[model samples]
Target: MAAVLEPLPQPDPPGAKTSASTDASHASGSGLKPIKRLISDSRIERIVPESNAATHLQYCSQFARDFIRADYNFCAAKVTVARGGKIRALDAAFRESGEWLGKALTWIEQHPTRSFPLEHEVIELKITHPLAGRLVRCLTQYDRIFVRSMEVLLAGKIQSHERETLLLNAGKRLKHIVQVCIPDNDAYLTDGTRKTK
Candidate 1:
């Protein structure tokens, strides 16, 4: 039996060289005061915003594109019953990008469209990374549908003026919520969170 693992170690990449203390004290140098925040009401987001969905969409597309470029597989799968690992990877990405990702997913779930093409002109033919090609191949038809839905949502291209399809806007709306939840900090980490002590 052969198995592959893709480990997501949280906010920090595995090879990052940095020192941080999980201590709250390190976060606040004796000020002992909660920083006033504009959003003050939600979870943190990995992408920063210029206070608009357009910006969020830009980041989202790049997030997908860059993610496709990264080499993060842990092992090759010899046998599998389903594509749980692939689904998990996508879920982790959504959570990291913003709360909106989950919202978008919900909309896609309800608005199931089997029209996802097995071959599309938009899927870039040139993938420079060798590993990404195999990764792409492992994607199930359902997985492809889900990802394509996200790509469309993040692209913000409103083609159908149908009200039912407007649910795609949920991603944009959640992105707004993310904008408010960002913490006030002197230093911003790569993922846009304040450094912990």
Candidate 2:
């Protein structure tokens, strides 16, 4: 079980160490296990599963990474950014998308069943194909158009709209994942169909 740490009281002086029992010290009063070391394997597994979550994570993360890199590179080049700046932008894009991918994987794990609109376990093979197309649409933030704040803030008045216009190949990869890969909610492959990941 995850420890619910209570907030610590304010110290007499800023950054001063309290001689009395703090919330952190009180929570681990038993001394049986350190509070920082108390995180369980299940909790870690919930973030990134060792066995089952890999398949979905692989496809979805790849698509996001590719999409971000492509979009950033295009914008950078169009704006006459230096090659080094473009490279740095690509790195930033991947890092941001990686954070999103981790959250997306956790959501996929919890939802479990994505074969239909009603959100139940799917038994048939055909249903999964169409469902991935829809599920990935949500997973990839399809409706939310991300506009970089720095780009807008730096563009001043003249280049604002031109700087933000960009395209991505994520749709092609998404189609391939849904139509061909058919990722299962089960981390393991139970049926005869082999998982690509």
Pick the lDDT winner: 1
> For residues 28-54, what per-residue lDDT tens digits would candidate 2 score against the true structure?
432322213212323322332112211
Worst 10 residues of 2 by lDDT: 118-127
Provide the TM-score for each candidate, comma-separated. 0.23, 0.21
lDDT of 1 by residue, 5-103 (tens): 122235767887656554444444433322222121121122222221110111123222332223111111111111334333333433443344444
Residue pairs with backbone atoms closer than 3 Å in model 1 (clashes): 4-75, 5-75, 21-197
Q: Residue pairs in steric clash, candidate 2?
A: 52-187
The TM-score obtained by model 2 is 0.21
Error of 2 at 153 (Å): 36
Clashes of each: 3, 1
Model 2: residues >4 Å from true position, as ranges? 1-82, 117-197
